[model samples]
Target chain A: MRIPLGRKIVTYFLLSTAALLVFMPTLMAVVMSFMTNQDIMTGSFPSAFSLDNYRRAFEQFSLMHYVINSLFVSIIIMIGQLVLSSLAAYAFVFLEFKGRDFLFYLFIATMMVPFEASIIPNFHTIRDLGWIDQYTGLTVPFFAMAFGTFLLRQNFKQIPKELREASQIAGMGEVKFYLTVVLPVAKTSLITLGVYGFLTSWNMYLWPLLATTNDSVRTVQIGLRQLQSQEQMNDWGMIMSGAVIVIIPTLILLFLGQKKLQRGLTEGALK
Target chain B: MTEAAATLSQEDYILFEQTKRKHRYKQFIKGMLFLLPSIVLFSVFLFYPLLRTIYLSFFLTDASGAPTVFIGWDNFVTLFQSSIFQQSIKSTFLFVLYTVPLTIVVSLFLAIIANEKLRGIGFFRTIFSSGMGISVAAASVFWLYLFHPTIGFLNIILDTFRLEKISWLTDPSWALIAISVTTIWMNIGFTFLILLGGLQSMDKYLYESADVDGAGYFYKLRRITIPMLSPTLFFVVTVTIINAFQTFGQVDILTQGGPQNATNFIVYSIYREAFTNYQFGSASAQAIILFIIILIMTIIQFKLGERKVHYQ
Candidate 1:
């Protein structure tokens, strides 16, 4: 249906403003990151841009350690979630059992419980398990993600059951059938889950900050916030640089996986 | 030949029975095994912690800073007596009141506009979703610069329109609104993405049918789009509710719960108690109460969703 000119104009205006709302802060942040400390204090752009703030951020803070730590944790989380969720999703989809539906519902039910509620006691659980200031505490709790399982299970369900039967007729066992038949069909959702897991883990702030008290174990987001607080005055340039440092990779992944994410998020969030 | 036939038939029967037994055993093992990780993680992380929190809430810490005695309602009583706690509750609700509806409406409008079959729509979609890749803390810091009173871009724009400078984050009354505006801007991207997915996933056949019946645009939207979109709407609202209540990072970075604790959300308050003051006992109590509140709100959402949200 063709929209009226008046409605089209209004839509265009609204969309332009929406885009502005999204871009204004990012543009400002990028511009501010290039400013010097003197420029920031004087409330204007510097006569010449310099890398001094970036240098200060690196020297004063263990910025590189936090970046590497966050990367290590996120990579581990992505791999761990991909392996476990795929295996579990394969089992749920291809292997028929007496109580399959019941188990799937149980998995879905856990997704409703917010992480905030879980964190308090889960913190003590980590403490009891002697994982404080350890990467295991960061990665282990996310091994059995209900949403990832659901995403992969939905993808696996799309395959024809006859394919599994065809593999069986060729004398293939269950695990081999899953490897040959099911895994190939589930490639996209698995990739989607991997990206989602990586990005989510990369951006997480509160949980890791609360779990570890030491500087050596902080994530990038926490590192930036810590740097912001430690400075004698808020250095817009350094803080913006820190923000840019943390966000670049996630942005790349989001761009690469936008198609699959669009599908996964809609399907996952829908019924 | 006869002897071979007899042996073959007998062996086939035995083999069939053995395979059946093995399948049964494997099914049992696989069922439990598939559930094993989830059961372990949920039990250790979710259930155990929940029970521990409940236990901790009722106990008082000793002089040694360990939980020692069953204080039994003392935490709850103290919470009621504290004006700051009461204020946090009010602030939290007010924050939710400002953000939730605005976010839903703004994102929904953007989704509708972006979902149109206009040229250059993908570029517009990407621009709107750019905020999703930025961290909340980073976004708040950026907003701080944008809302700078004297030389900020916002002031420059307002001056062009002959308006006086508004101290967005500094003024007490407008501080929450300023924080809220930033929250809405940072958050609307995800909500818009979800809603756009819903809009695109919708069957085109429904619109064609409505058109055949001479349905107007608003009519189709109201009668068809809204009802079909309820499931997505419900999901977005659920996420928004959880995010709104636990909005810690933005308040921490932008306002620091400032201007007389206007933005001191319950989660931040809990953080300050536990980390800043080392009042672990009180913090745990606050966390437990916050959990109960979220649980109740979620239950109510589920109940409402069952009646209104359409799955298919």
Candidate 2:
């Protein structure tokens, strides 16, 4: 059952090539970030690496403010989606109410409708609410998500029904039972949802671009876009530095939460 | 005594029915309370916008984004007749065609290779899946560096080989292809993860049985692995197509749908129509048309997948 040595070699070669192709861009970005602007334009490796690009990126571009804006928006979205989706999921799973099935379908149906279809009206809604260029405009509309609710509901339904009945019989209120038992049991799914929500909000480009016009509220993705336009001709190193800064947080989150992110993505697909 | 007992049973039944109705009301109240926040947000953001898009598509709007007059079918007609709109449609489909199948084929190959049990496999898997963490904007910047005509890494490589440098993003012929390369690279990590998960979860017995029957590697792959992997393949294809259709960020950052509008994706067109030109009605029409295209394409995929996908 042993494969030939030649075949193994080919397999390794291909896998290694694919892996390098995937990782090379980010690595090049990092490499270019350390080089001088002259070195980058000349396509030369840095003789002496410096943090000048990073310094210029922050000082000149106000990269810190955009990072803070992105962090604030993503964190709020993560917390909002987790809390709201879990509550709705709990009701969908544990409570008995008329039109429950119909309501669940309605929520799920929203997943199919592309966000582009709604961007204009949602913009108008925000403008009317006088939330333009505000934190609320950037984060509030994304607080409720059908995907998070669906993921949590599927997990919640797997919890035994008798546990809920037992809690009720012991004179425990629904809120108390949910807080004590359900939340703890569904922790993994919640973490998965949180990571997914955070990444999506953090990487959001079009909506944030439309919503925020200035540096006061623009997210990191928009900041990158601005950097590209503002420094149109030169300063490759500084712009790559900006790219590195924008990507660093997401990479850290991915490395730290790889298991949960993978699980979140593949969970419903298998079913 | 028997008649009195029957009367008591009936009275108890009535009391039980009253309590059940009251409990139902309470449960309904609690459910609505739990759902109230989500409902309000969804109604304001998702549902209302969807309906409004349709409604606005039928009107002619002013420069201020307010509806000025009722223009029935005018916007749709104008877009349908416009050559740029037509080109956008062609380009959108071409984008999907360029990205989807290649993503599936290449990622599946990588997944199969990475699926092998070897030393340092986890490191390789992480490298293969690392693109998942890179956002569209960051990835676009990296690619913009690589595809720059005079001072690009790719052209540098071409120079070493004594070959002519290609104008990747600036040339109309190469613009879409360059954007497609970036998207394909960006998508590889996601599609690889999904396919690798599928490969890991496959039943090993089928491969063993095929070996016992004296089947060659290609035969086993064709007969066993492909059929067994259809469900995952179906899922990957659907997601890749949908994502390809909605491609915006890379196009915006890299090409600005330029080089003679070679990379003018439908979403970018929609964005320009609304924001840049202040033609909200036209943008709404374009968005609706894109939605319809995506919807029909998805339905067609589902219909085709229903017959081919294998289920355990």
Q: Which candidate is the best by DockQ?
A: 2
DockQ per candidate = 0.54, 0.72
- Model 1, residue B234: distance off in Å is 2.3
TM-score for all models, in order of appearance: 0.89, 0.96
Whole-model Cα lDDT of every candidate shown, in order? 0.80, 0.89
Off by over 4 Å in 1: A1-10, A45-52, A59-62, A97-102, A232-234, B1-23, B62-66, B148-167, B209-219, B301-311
Residue runs of model 2 more than 4 Å from their true location after superposition: A1-8, B1-11, B298-310
> What is the lDDT for A112 in model 1?
58
Cα TM-score of candidate 2: 0.96
Q: Which run of 10 residues does model 1 chain A get worst, by summed lDDT?
A: A227-236
Query: What is candidate 2's fraction of native contacts?
Result: 0.69
Distance from true location, Cα of B102 in model 2, Å: 0.9
- Return the lDDT, model 2, position A50: 91
